[model samples]
Target: MEEKLSKEKIVQAAFQLLRENPELEKLSMRKVAQKLNIQAPAIYWHVENKQALLQSMAEEIENHFVAPKPKENWKETIYAYMENYYELYQQYPCAIEIEIQTIPSYPSRLRNLDAILGILNEAGFSIELSYMTITSLQHLLFGMLMDSSEEKKLYNKVMAGDDYLKKQIILMKQYVQEHELKNISESIQYRQKEKQKDFFMKTLRVFLNGLDTFV
Candidate 1:
């Protein structure tokens, strides 16, 4: 007998397709059906359409997230949560894109958001402040991952001898130096000197420290 097809199976198949090809544009119900050895019409019966499939895929990713246990120090808890969240996004190809495209209606996403808000509330932040904090942190995390992903792709092309990009990089560096833009030059050099994770954590700490003053 053929194995049963559930939403779970369909979502898993879609994840596999993403793993094999990280480009979000290439993902489709037809491709997922091909991966699962099913007809495209069958996928529509369960998922309705590509947007719905993406929503399912986004929820599936959230389901895997294990939120950090609450700590007495709210900053510590928030830091841990952000770090774990970063790693989770890094684990899946096109994960950040999937998250950006979907609404956070899933249980896991809501639970995690609630947990963060609770932590901030306990830390003496007003509801407005707590919401703003979470929103800012998410923007930082999502923006970082999106930039990193695109940067890696560009770097790969450079590694493959993309002479045009190489020349552009050199020219940009030269422009900065020739223009005597001390702050920008120093910042670029500083970033290049540290590992990306270290830089991100340092920035996160700075943000949290600023928020601490408000608390």
Candidate 2:
């Protein structure tokens, strides 16, 4: 007797694989099948294709993004929603890439986007502006998280000792001198931690201010 394959089982296996793997670079149906000790053909019985499997994984992540209910104050609601999304992505780094590529037409993803738009609409943004605001907010949050993770790695190294940063700074200065670069201070200032936070915060404030203009 042939056993009936289960879609839920395949999705669970895929999710487990994603969680265990730090890099989602090799997320393939073959790898999933290897994890489940099943043939790739058997996986096809459940997931239509690799894209469909990724879509399913994306839908699950969107569920997390939309879990928070709309709040009394629009700004507060949006702040919390963005915070929730950032926390989720931080927990599942793969989510950053997944959210970037997933189609908004999918039911769960659409519902999440609609929820965000609903908040902006309640805040008195026009329909078109609300759409723009929602996407901008998402991109801003994702960009910050991604940039922070990358910078933090370098930051840890630099903080490890003055000698490390000195060596790198000396190399950079030599490169700049050889290149006859102007505004080395400006370049260094831009890369400084204080400047990075100020830029991120200022960008968020500007976005919120623009949202205010829509009101």
Candidate 3:
């Protein structure tokens, strides 16, 4: 007997395609249908269009996120939540891109956002401040992941004997040294020596510490 087609099945298929390709633009209903051995029009019955499919895929990703339990200190709760969130994003290909293209209207996404904001509110933050805090943290996570993704691509090219990027890095370092830009030079060296996960945690701690004064 043929299996039933449902939103969940469609989303899973689409996500599978995304995992294989890791390029959002390359995902199409036709392709998804091909994967499922169904006609392209069948997907429209569930997803409406590509944008909706993307939103569904994003929600599917969010559904896997395991938020930290509430802590005595709200900062501890937030820190743990962020750490988990970063790892969740790392598990999926093009996860950040899927998130960037979707609205946070899905049940899972809203629940997570509400929980974080509620923690901030209970910690004596104004609604506006809580919103800003969550937004800023998201920006940090997304920006860092996006940068890491691009860096990985560049690293691959460098590994493939791409001298242009290597030369650019050398030129920048030489220019910094010649100009005696001590701070920039030192920061570059420090970043090179630090693991990305360690850097993220250090930055997260710094941000939370700064927020301590405001609370």
Candidate 4:
């Protein structure tokens, strides 16, 4: 008789598969089966389908990232959450992709949001400001984490090189100037340069400056 398998075991297997593979496009029932040494049909017995499997994996990852910890200050709480999220995405880039692709009604996300909302309230920010601030923070961190996770080595390589991006920007600006579209190109160039200036830190600083007005 075949040995009975538990759902936890199946999820564990899925986690192993996710960690081993760099790309999810190559993930399939057959591949999962091969990893577990079980038939593809056996996987369906644990997860309804591939989407269900991916969803479960995403939930597991979110759980790992959003756990509560003792934080005395709102800024520390928010920064701690963002730092953990960045680290989590760095380790499991696949989970970040899965999270972006799916709209999860998971408890992990809800709990984290609730905690953030509470922290903002305690800091005397209005409900609207609190909601918008949390949303903005999530967007900034998500963008950074995704960008870093997807191309960490490539980004480091580019940054380490002798100003390749800067050289391209200068070339583009010259072309734009000669074409009499300097304003449009300048706006694009300005935004790209702004990113290099640690805009996330600047945005948070500005938001904090306005916190007193909100209170």
List model 1 lDDT by residue over 1-215, tens digit each.
98888889999888888888778989988899999998888877788888898898889888889888876799999999999898888788899999999999989999989888988898899988998999899999999889988998899899999999999999999999999999999999887898878878888999999997799
Highest TM-score: give the candidate number.
Answer: 1
Clashes of each: 0, 0, 0, 0
- The per-residue C-alpha lDDT of model 1 at residue 57 equals 86
lDDT of all predictions, in order shown?
Answer: 0.89, 0.73, 0.90, 0.71
Global lDDT for candidate 3?
Answer: 0.90
- Tens-digit lDDT track for model 4 on 1-215? 97677566676676678677657777776777787788888777888877787777778777777554857877667666666676676666476678777667788877877877888888888888888887787777677656656665456556788487658757877888889896797687776678532565566556555665656
Off by over 4 Å in 1: 177-182
Q: Regarding lDDT, does 3 or 4 come out ahead?
A: 3
- Per residue, candidate 3 scores C-alpha lDDT tens digits across 74-135 of 99999999999999999888899989988989999999888899899999999888988998
What's model 2's TM-score? 0.71
Displacement of the residue 22 alpha carbon in candidate 1, Å: 1.6
* Inter-residue clash pairs, candidate 3: none
List per-candidate RMSD values in Å. Answer: 1.8, 5.4, 2.1, 6.0
Instruction: In model 2, state the lDDT of residue 80.
Output: 69
